[model samples]
Target chain A: MTYDPVLLANIDKKDSHTLPVYQSGGGYRGLRRALEDMSPADVVELVKQSGLRGRGGAGFPTGAKWSFLPKNHPGPVYFCVNADESEPGTFVNRVQMELDPHQVLEGTIISCYATGASTAYIYLRHEYPLARRRMQAAVGECYAAGLLGENILGGGFSLDVHIHVGAGAYVCGEETGLIESIEGRRAWPRIKPPYPAVEGLFRKPTVVNNVETLACVKQIVDRGADWFRSMGTPPDPNDPRDPGSFGPKLFGLSGHVNRPGCYEAPLGITVRRLIDEYGGGVWKGRRAKAAIVGGLSTGLVTEAEFDTPLDFSAPIRAGCLGLGTGGVIVLDETYSMIDFLHNSCRFFAHESCGQCTPCREGTQWALEMLERIRAGRGRLRDLDLLREIGETIGIMPGTTICGLADGAAWPIKTALGKFREEFEGYVKEPTTV
Target chain B: MNVLDAETRENIDTIAGRYPTRRAAVLPVLHAVNDRLGYVPTEAVVELAELLELAPADVQDTLSFYGFFKQDKPQGEYRVWVCRSLSCAARGGEELLEYLCEKLKIRPGETTPDGRVTLEFAECLGACEAAPAVLVNDTLYGNMTREKIDELIRRVRAGTHHDATE
Candidate 1:
């Protein structure tokens, strides 16, 4: 695993946040190369060839997303960088922003060029004041260095980058919700068919990407596509259509692990290795019981399932959601699954935007049911009710405006499905009320 | 009477200039007010609406959606937020919060009688890598322990806790 580091190479360097230090370490070289040597179409083609996917939860292909934009659109195109890293177990984006703000800026400039966007916005989470300060400083540096503003780097490409801090909403991580938030409205997700590429952020063609995804773009431009694709194992070995997951991915390891920091590895690294080798095994010399591969929105897997590869498709094949934000939460034998689901449900209920009927109503009901069970007043049929509610909210397509409801429902269904016995143990026979 | 002071109004105007539309600066303007004034008063919302060219109701609607902005009254000098999410909870985050509440003689989301410290539970500060994290004001303290809490309270009371902004 002696692979060369790309995104995190300069993360630990002294004064890494400073523009001079970043430039000395070869920062903004991608922007330089893109602006001077490559065409906007060439940059997009390189990204497509590199097999880079969104580092945010969804795992959508980055280049393909850019390709969806209608070429030669009349109005101004926009680029919204999703720095609102609010996923419960994820902190990698915050680290990237804090340590190497210039890397994110470089990647963003490249993305704006590739997408034909003249204006860019970084939707940062409000809780991260340190990250915000660093980003503000870095953007100022870029503007002073002539890397931003009109005619950047003496090239005809011009882009304006602004930092828009989100007040406190998890749904804003959703692209359309982020666009709405940027528009000075509540972060309610818009329906697809008019995706961001078609109409976003003031009804103009927009490309919204996550922080880590944009950072990877800088590396993809610096190194050739084949060089970038050489690291990670793909989904299908034989078929190029699958593009198998490639490049380095940052895994946010936390909870009960001895070392709970963000670790970078190839996309298809095994979960067992990540937990034992990189995480330094479970804390207090305890054995790991279950693990949440991605964020809280994803399902839990038992210790036996630890062998599953950490990729977008591998975890889903193992009956969980894809590699979402790469936020791996480990639960030891001492932890209670019941309490875990309760906390997760509470977050969903509080954060749901109340846009759609099912998500608004379903999340609250699920939380109520979980609370009742935790209080030892749970009926035997309540488990069945929980299952039905989760399935109805998540299993059905077009049930809600965004995937928040589905994110709310998946953990409930998966937690109950795997830990039914633990849930059953908490159930009390109904006493006549 | 204007809820926002001259400096806050000027700061809000500057932020509004960053955006193409004045309405897009609502959150940043509110944040600036909260940073300076401690809480967003109803009068401030009315004034902000005039600044951003929106209705008072529109400002209030956006303000109500987010829990970060406190509208009722000024917060304590030190706002202590204990992370109670799963990762932090696993590593004594809840116990730490309970301990603080017992020592401070206040429940979560309540300020002490002295108005020096307000205790609250945060979902996740994105610092789970250092479990049982606590955020006082904007700066986050990680791997927090009982002794650390005691020291923090002492510093806040002594008016010696290092302010991130300063």
Candidate 2:
């Protein structure tokens, strides 16, 4: 019922090469209005009113992010779409860019116009060459339609979008790290305070929003803010002030679930509903033993909280888990949770970006502990040490230069906290059947 | 077809203009060449390096650094890339990849003798849902199994893959 017919959002996977097709489907109409009708400040105001947040992971308000640009700073501002989607379970942005490249371009253009940014960059991961090609073609389509370049839409406003493919690095998904990668440096995060909004991308004021966040701009402008606010969960009685904080999130369902794919559901949909209703339940009628709600890094929720709503705040408050990236990974009865944790810890360890001491050493220590435990070579104290290390590094959120430290630390801590019995069970039996 | 098409060549030139020095366009030029030729050959690498005013070794280094570029040989016309990261691996990707190699009658890194298909191992293709998934050339196939891969390869080889939309 959350699916709106008006906002079905066509995925032009076919014939993505033509401008006529995109234009026929009401493309460039958002950009057209932004250029001719809305002034820069006016556009920013509309976004602020819309209550849109960044769809990447950190749910920062999109308009507030745009408004973060210092007005007194007498220089050029930039918008870098964080298309560097190297998150483990998050691949929603790739489809958003690939299926509707023009939509993304339009949103980027509108954002650039609103932000008074003459230049915008889509920093994509290098593995996504197909997406890079499609984005480039979409940019070309925009230019051909006179929606970009000099005097766009006869508004005397010129904007340029450059697609920069990043070399493979998970750290680059972090906004500041992405800016560094775009600036032709190593893909490690910079310290905040000098956040990307204040001083980013060649040391100028820059706003980095996720690809999905940018893509949502067109819908907000075209349909108006009230329309978007209508779809998501009604404001909770608990939080009357920010009822519409989290909107419809695209859940990337993976693992042993049948019909596993990206399902655009409202924020408050339950894990059980997503499994039974949207995903057709577990594959081959297998019992769902564990479900990693927000990716491998997020806590593995067991049978206790299966009916927990899959929103940001609810899962955090109830089950101590946040919907980071909205990646729901269902594990069947046969899968080994310890092995999976071991594998995930290895990934975090490998991609730590080596910036801070806690993250660099803590991630390595976690993986090593997981490896030893998985290999049936660990003492009970080692299990305690795993919990200790995870907790010690968990205190440093946004403490390191980038979020990788937090990314590596938080999941381990949460998993240890939630699944201590499972870890302990692994110690005694080695194989829990 | 050795040279890029007119439009593609122009696009490559535009990437070249982005860098202050031409030598910096090596990676971008390699992408253009790969997009055109399906894989970067020795001749294309030499030509690109020469065009970018760098040693061939520089281009080779970049190709090796990234899993996308193939330097030793050309992948077949149909390149099936399976993601081999943690999520996919946990979701039975190893078995699926093994099944693909057997069905294709080539190793994971080898192209079929007929030049019709090539199997390459990718790390986290961003399509975790498709877990045990493969990208046959540009099209993404997800929720895959050995039987599914077998049927797909058969249809592709027989030229009956009418649904091949990249």
Candidate 3:
């Protein structure tokens, strides 16, 4: 790991979750700097220069997202910090919210100021009760200390931060779905363009950001934009659209690893280094069979591809979805590929918003097919059918409203593409008999 | 006929006021009622509609979409959610859940006869690092083992709570 742990610095301290403990270590100094010395546009410019990407799967450029709010809009612009860490094999937001909530809050306040958002909401997952309690308390502390709500630190800007808890829906993690949930509606994600930035949350412009993305905003002010950009990959000058993964990321390492926990490492760290150096290596002296590139939705990395860097564009080069929440789950050799695909497929099936027919029905059908294969009743031709379902369901293919179909498709594609023999061996048996 | 009491109604109104539209306050309002009343009664949904100035069906429309709300009846004293996602499943979470069911003499989503616990299969509690993790009501117990589960069940049965390791 080339970078020291920045976000997790105060996590292990005795009273880390408390505001005093956080502030004592120059916590709000970034907020103070932005509030006292700089303009809101300055903050946005600095972030744009830093090349920070969203940590919540999409890897969208944060500064670009902030700049998307229509200039001088007629209505209230909202900023929603997504703390809904419901992705399978992911818990980065939960740890940050539970242990270092003020960091997230400080980043949130700074982002709100830069984006001209007068109202902000921390959309916390319902399952995370502990994170909710601590974050709620931290919000109160910030309100009391003039860091949030009504002329924050006398900076001539005011923002109201509220905690809106989710009710056990993974779809709520999707930006538009989050907006819908907060509006007291069923958490079905809306179709874009009048994207959230234009018309969202009571038909007004809104900015939805990941918890860790906002935390990065606070650190960018503390450290120079150059310092933030120095760590992760720079833009591929060849690809104009590639914004390049930058800064330290909270990589949640789990499954078959000795030291399975959240680690703050730079964006370009390889799977080998992350597993051996930080994760204490695969458990029980077993060889790693496959690794989820970054959460189940991102798909799997074969043993040969373990050397691939986990940066945003690198994962795509490694034939998976972009670094989707940086949740790396290593599966040792003893683990079954059938189990892996089943769980990944099942999650997408269960969590699909059910609005889009291809994602809703397609995911369920795929999962049922996997269950049949697992139950020793699958045909040799069923694998091709599964692939066909996956290929047609995602937004990229124009079959679904959201990227969820794409997320569900990945593991199936990767598992079948890379670990086909394992799956073939399982299915070939029932077919021959 | 009167489902929401004076205190509950006041609480719902306070929650409803937080949002721009009463329709938008349906979730937080229902959460508050669910937290206090154990489960949201169908009649209370009607009361909340009147309070928020929406039709009862509108409130119910949003209410039924989310899985956490229990409209039929109150849940058991404790809700033990065993995660069965990839990480946890790889690390004995499936077996642990089965062990729990066998010991409790009830399948998942069923409450024990004594009304002490409600076992459910959680997708992922975002505690993958602590694979084989279970949430005993609101507290997440990470690095869970059968022995740890035994202690947890005993504690819950005894009507007690313990702090999660920091």
- Those runs of model 3 whose alpha carbons end farther than 4 Å from true positions after fitting are A430-433, B162-166
Q: Share of real contacts kept by model 3?
A: 0.89
Task: List residue ranges in candidate 1 displaced over 4 A.
Answer: A237-241, A428-433
Instruction: For candidate 3, write residues A22-45 as lDDT tens digits.
Output: 999899999988999999899999
TM-score of 3: 0.98
lDDT of 1 by residue, A37-91 (tens): 9999999999999989899998888999999999878759989999998888889
Over A325-378, each residue of candidate 2 has an lDDT whose tens digit, in order, gives 777788787777677777678878877877788888988998988888888876
Fnat: each model in turn: 0.67, 0.32, 0.89
Among all candidates shown, the one with the greatest lDDT: 3
DockQ order of candidates, top first: 3, 1, 2
- Model 3 has a DockQ score of 0.78
Interface RMSD (Å), every candidate: 1.3, 3.3, 1.5
| Highest TM-score model number | 3
- Model 3 agreement with the true structure over B1-166: per-residue lDDT tens digits: 6877788788876776677788878888888888787789998899899999999998999998888888888778888999999999999999999999999999988888888788998999999999899988788888899999999888888877664533
Model 1 earns a TM-score of 0.97
* Inter-residue clash pairs, candidate 2: none
The model with the greatest DockQ is 3
